[model samples]
Target: MTLTHRLLSPLIVALAFSAPVVTHAATDPSFVLTATSKNFDNYFPSYLANGYFSTMTSVRGSEANLAYMVAFMDYAKDDIARPAAIPGWSGIDYSTGKSTAGEFWLNRTLLSDKAFSDYQQTLDMHNGTLTTRYRYTDDSQKSTRIEITTFVSQADTHLAATRITITPEFDGSVQLSFPLNIWAPHQPRFPIGKMTGDEMLAAVAANNMSVTEPVNYRTADRAPVWYHGDTNVSNDDGSTKDLTLQLDGKAEQGLHMAEAAAIELPKGIKPSDITLDKSTYQLALNMKVPVHKGHAYSFTKYVAMSRESWGGDASATAALAKKARSTGFDKLLAAHQTAWHTLWQSDIVIDGDAKVQQAVHSDLYYLLSNSTSGTAWPMGACALTPNYAGHAFWDSDSWVFPALLLLHPDRAKPIVMFRHRTMQPARERAIQYGAKGTMYPWEADPETGIDYTPHFAYGVFREIHVNADVAIAQWQYYLASGDSAWLKANGWPVIKEVADFWVSRVSYDKANDRYEILHVTSPDEAYDDVPNDSFTNAAARKALDIATAAATKVGASPDPQWADISKKMYIPFDAKARRHLDFDASVPHDKITWMGSSLAWLMYPNLDLPMSPEIRKNDFDFQLEELKVHGNDPNEMMMVMLATAAAEVGDGKTAGEWLQRNLVGFLKPPYNVRSETASNNAGYILATSAGFVQSLVYGLSGLRIDDNGLTEAYAPALPPTWKSLTLKHITFRGKRYDITVDRDAAGNAKLTRKAL
Candidate 1:
């Protein structure tokens, strides 16, 4: 579809059908261009081009449900208590086998009834492109049926890349059985090997595996295994019989295995009860399956059969598996890739800065790789990184959603729906905190929907603004996508609940004749426990306005109560400081500063506060003087926000400077990869990509959207060394626009925009 038609068709139809017009636009193409940077190539090669397998380690449980488990019999060890070690093993120092006595040993010793630890794992690749087979046995020679299903996409060209749920069944006494043999082209490696039986037992004892919290134990054991799988495994196995085992370490040699014994079931219950039902268990496997540059590999495996003794019929499982195989898995994976392609296809390229192009693609790839299927929470809000222990934060809705909406509106919807799915939990949180409306958590455990904000001081200060942030994101989604069904169903209810909360939560300041948000912190945590926080007030007002507007549009009654409260919401301004206060009475310190001044509260959307040229200059000066700490804190998001703000105020010179600083200072150079933290950072390369987008859209092109329409203020301030720039698919005023800024042969500069 043409960019103009794709963006404006819905609005035109809505206007014809008596619906309100939503003036949303796609990203600019010049800004969306692609390039090869050593920095990006070194840090995020998976995003640069097409590939088959991408492994995801579960930062939280929501991500953990996507892997499988494998066990094996230790034939070399005369006693199952101590399995013989393979040669030349080197991986994690942790023990793998179970142990009872010889507590100080490093091998598996069966003690306290815990079964020997089994490796939990998973395989991910393009759907239908590759097939995987595992060899194993069942009790008494009963038939073992394996079933397989794909969860993400069903397209033939794309891979089913998300969660792969696995269930295993067996016959006989409910003893532990190791069924999986190989992951096809890739062989498994034992990291801890070669210790004596006593040492193995001691190591297992020291590890302290727990029975009740099986998930934790499974995760800890599986992480080391997969880490080895990704980093060490090679495709060349000598033969099927010589499966290329790497167990040279003493711990592996002394590893013990438990005798095959099943859990005892009650009489009259079928053997199936003792196996698949009563013995239901889960494991998390995160292994990086290698992929050739241009070739696609599909990951396939059978969820091994249910035992015959329990009338094990694979019909239902098989049917579901076939359905996934036929349609869901491949289609989902393809759609995800298509989503990324759509980003590249609709990208607005910038001509001069090669770094900008690389950064943009990297960000787009990161967002695609980490997002989930509809109704599933996005990859813990932090996008597969270990920062914040994989917890979902307010940034998912406030910052991430907005960026996605402009670039890829279709994929952006699911993220908003995820918030709707969690509404009930949010409501419950509100009641727990003695509030009238929903109070979303500042940080949430992705799988459990549990809040985990630790109290630092006197009392647990609830970041009440999260509820407002959610409401605004949903409203923005509605505006961008023009999905009335979503608005009426998902958006309306959330809007009402959040609006209700604001109404009940705000207190009337009789002296000032304004509604006050008391004891709230703005987006920047520099100032806390302040009254009438300007950022919070601005967001609350925006939320109230959107809620009222959406309510009116959907034929819902506009609550007059909201009007009274909205009229009174306080937005504090500092006259002497000559800049907006972070919060009411926010004291500016000589040394104490916000972590990232670029992400100050006023910069976010729906807040509707503009930074004047004078104010922008002052804020830039303040940030440069005080906020540029070592440059690694707050991850890459800080750079993105800073670039965005710099672009906003027509300071192209400053914006370009900031962009280059991030690229060279943190994103490039000696490290040459994106880092999660200062010391133990992994190569996560999305932040710089996002920064590139922000620099172009918010900086040079000056695109801003609102109810009236899209507005463009030309502000191209390229460095003197650069000659020209061009961008395509820059959306504004309900139209697709292509813009170019270049210096003519005569040295005169020109800016041109044409409706697509």
Candidate 2:
């Protein structure tokens, strides 16, 4: 069997579940994700994020050394001039792996075997909290239980808190330790050829590596530059003279991270001793706490991490940590809960299928957690890991931004602003490519506002559709938001420039009397340098139309050619077959690794490329059947597009099956964190989550955004198992509406819209 066939096995199994599997209802206040030893791999722990910071930890406290923590930093030039692994916030001591135990682990108090029982962790999405509890017996045969609760605050973007509570079965004294350390040092990882001249000199000087004929240095993998804190001296130093030299000047400029932490003891309790280790710069606190049976004593730790590269102040970090400690965990948690509660107001409600409802909730939670209103730092495709070098892509505007625009326009605004703020770089990129108007890069760097696409990928030059994607998001934001002031200030510039670009990009065929976009990469990614790709052509046409309307709304003269270009945009279609082709010369049902849905997007979202129901059904049948014939495994967004297109065509059964395929293919267990593929190579892809959620809002409910604003485009086509599907608090034209799609006794879906 081919690898693609193996990838489809999960979807095949999902087809077996014709009936609803009984599960906890999403409405249950206690509906929370629980993590166990069996649920998550130790290496890749479950994740928690709040836009600014993210943390991952295992249930076994003993393996706390392996915990991962990262905070958002504005882009900076470090060891290399390209995308590389930036320093994390796990602390200098934490990265060394010397501390086998964590702050939660009881020091020298457990039995000889040191085994823990009844370990479980509950992740409450509503509160954005992770609560871990476990019990262990001491050498005295006395039972003790510990609970640790952690959260990255939504109220304060810089603050993170962890509160630990201990209860003793009998009256006994236990020793506890708290750690304070600087942020983890930068350990640069990148190809040597990607480094600048000064970076190479520094690396060669520090590592004593030979670099003869440096001008002709081969592009090869190099060891990460070891930035050692005083604590790491023991691990790296041999002689005292060498150690002194390394400590004095080895650390590079623009790489230092300023981190501060404070610990708050319970009332009437104080630490027995406080000591700081100079070697590791790790502060330790030894506290003997007296506890009675059934009584709990708690301590909270507050940490604030920032970086010079991120424009962070060391004093501010210390002050923030101090403020959080004084505010106490109860109040901090309350504020965080209040913030998340307000965000969750816009939600997806599914009845009769608890599993689907839970998955939707998880999707909403992750997307919301990865984005905030005021920052221009858009979310990457994958939220947790630096997948694709943490660079924003069309995924942000095309997939993630659309999902948020309907539910939370406030969060979506920053995504568009990210593009607006980087327009200078885009203009420069256009000049670089000899194109008219602004040309947004395929991979956008947040800090530098430059195209971060590596030299290896041709996408920087060929993936020209990103310009249209960016403009579509801006115009859609204006239509949904009804923010004319913003449209004038931010939206007009982007849309107008994009319009000028399309005017310059298209070549007029005087003989054919039409315009065409040639030598482009379609979203399918399988075919590159193709002429008049259907998805690109349709999007370009839509973008031109949007640009024309935006210019009119903003009191700017509309581009004369925009209308002509949009009217005569060459979208490849087979007239006799009544089906759309991927390109001017294309074969239907060809083996596309990134199969299906590129053409489907033109039908469902764009709603252009005029096709009849017969054509739509033919396209849907061919795409679905092609998945099995040549071992074609489609991407997550493709599944969403197929599902949405099927729903638009009133094929609820096929749409429902595709929805099930998405759930089984991408979403993981315990937490519905989505993977890029069914094989789970890159997990926590926010774009997949957004696409799945989009189907629930726009597909099942049959909602579409147009000049008239949030109107029903087609009949609701909900899955058979889904008795009712509701999109609550959808914002459009400065108003909120609740849309419910319900199936009648006759088994036909009906939709109702209620304004709030």
Candidate 3:
């Protein structure tokens, strides 16, 4: 087998979403943001991302989302989201465990005022590179321009470096203050980072961050300067004075945070020169570089962010930042950019449609930034964002993984590898649940594999299909990578444990020969703990089939019952509705709606059952009608899944519309995607990016793979308005290829390729 796989499609090509709701709504959109024509001022973002970690700036042009220094904040500290626990760090004293709770939030503004909210700012982002032009005023009424160029270090996945060039119009120095976190207006707890003086101060000095770059410090070069604020600042919104550590007795409360800070600055700019006052909890940065008027003096800083929730100590994280700074920002930035450029092997060219092209590029950018070849830990459900606490959920396996597998299977490998690494916890959880096999947590973080869903939270905890999700992902990885060795070494163990869980979990009825899963939550959370969910049953059965087949392929001993159970699994369907039953035939399908209730995933991404145009149409119609009442908050994935289903029904117009609906509203300026209002929420954009590409793969292109190889290929669902759609540098199995469809009256649209 030379891996010469091809899917024949119409000689034409075209493509596609993520969203948060603000007061912005418009008619059907014709364009999305692109590389050149964006106003970065609206969002104030630029990044250095490496799948699991990102070092970024907020709209106000200050450091944000790194270790989530603060949770959700606003001018009024009324309601704030609590901190979540990363591997080395924990969330702000939370109790529950699901993404909604006990998740780290990374939202903070080192300097914010209602007045500065409208300051002049410009940002330019392309792939892993970002340049921010921030213009603000100082106390001397001098216009200060902060040019912050940021990139996540590819050489060190744990660090992101920023080069700050500041040119002040006058000779006066500005004072930077750290304020108590403000509460969000809409919700009691906004999904943001939160840290008081003690935690922030201890985090730096406890880990020796102050000396992380002493050499750089001594030479009048750049050094990392750290800051943790005191809770007793005079100003509530952090707009006023104070950098001197207040020796007034209260400083002892933070005495333990006694080490130096990790805030990076130029060597000539010493803290003692600018120290007005400081408390152990909170301190300010006040430095004058003799930086008088007109000279642009730039300082670079590095921050180390681990993939785990938190590092064991400060040095573990600070040393990483120090090494990156030592490497110099230019070298790290170039390496980061080059690393991203190399991995951007697969791309789509939508000729004559810049918005679609830019949207696709933006989607691909996030997917690329949030992933690499060997680890799944950083590609959290909300990668590098504090909102989801950098946790992996079913989203990795179901939504994000499949798309990566299509174009970059190598990048998708860590999903399987990470799961294998965490299987022991699954086994332990299975034991706790009194089940025979592994039970994967619905929301996973490295600190504790124990299900983080709040205890007794039946809705997500009862969602046993997470185990099946991992199994399917393993099988899919094997199919895509064709790595038999990996299958034996890592894949088999997970599949076997999943099998152990399923066989024990399934209830066999003596009166009937069918096996059924009981009291389980399928994709639809609305129908919590329902029996025989169509997707769940079908997935378990497929898992069994994959396990048995994979065992033989990899020369492993098989469980005889695996085949029997898969063969006898019961999947309920409604003949009258002509759609798979939400629970059983008795339950009204119209009453259910969730991310999974869109129902087309089983046919497209899951490939659990074959669906013809008629069935696919019927299901899509049923979901739309049902959703009029039962719909949950509009999600990015649901929109993408519906697009997939729509394209399957030969409705490229409908498919394109579904994706556009998200792009116009869900995405902000510069095309950043939001997922369920979480931080770094960009990972949610994977759905839109994957939807566009997968709609081509599974919808328009009708691509499929099985043991026999290239099992199915059909015509493309090219939108009438587009000129062409191309997926180049597609890595399928061990071979590289391209898929292109062009709008033409004549000439073949075959993709001819060798190497790139």
Most lDDT-accurate candidate: 2
Candidate 1 similarity to native, TM-score: 0.58
Residue 176 Cα positional deviation in candidate 3, in Å, after optimal superposition: 8.2
**Candidate 2 residue pairs that clash:** 231-279, 231-280
Worst 10-residue lDDT window for candidate 3 reads 1-10
Candidate 1 structure quality by residue, lDDT tens digits, 379-498: 443344322324455656765566666655655566577677777877888888778767777655454445544222112243467777888888877776666787998989989889
What overall lDDT goes with each candidate model? Answer: 0.43, 0.65, 0.53
Query: For residues 1-756, what per-residue lDDT tens digits would candidate 2 score against the true structure?
Result: 112111211111111111222223543442476655343233234566777556654454322221112223223343222222222222211110112243334433332324456666666788787776777654445667777878878888777777777776776455655554323444544443245435544543454345453421112112232111211111211111111101111122223444456667678864443333333433443345555788877777676755434435555566777778778889999999899888888888888777777778888888987887776767765664444445677888888888999899888898899888889999998888888899988877655567756443434367788899999889888888888999999999999998888888898988989999988877666566778888888889989999889988988899789999999988887788677777786534365465643567676563434567788777767566655554344667778888888898898888888888887857655566676666533466777899888888888878877789887877899787778888889888888988899977798999988999
Model 3, range 103-126, lDDT digits (tens) per residue?
221123223332132333322233
TM-score of each: 0.58, 0.82, 0.73
Error of 2 at 191 (Å): 2.0
lDDT of 1 at 486: 74
**Location of the lowest summed lDDT over 10 successive residues in candidate 2:** 241-250
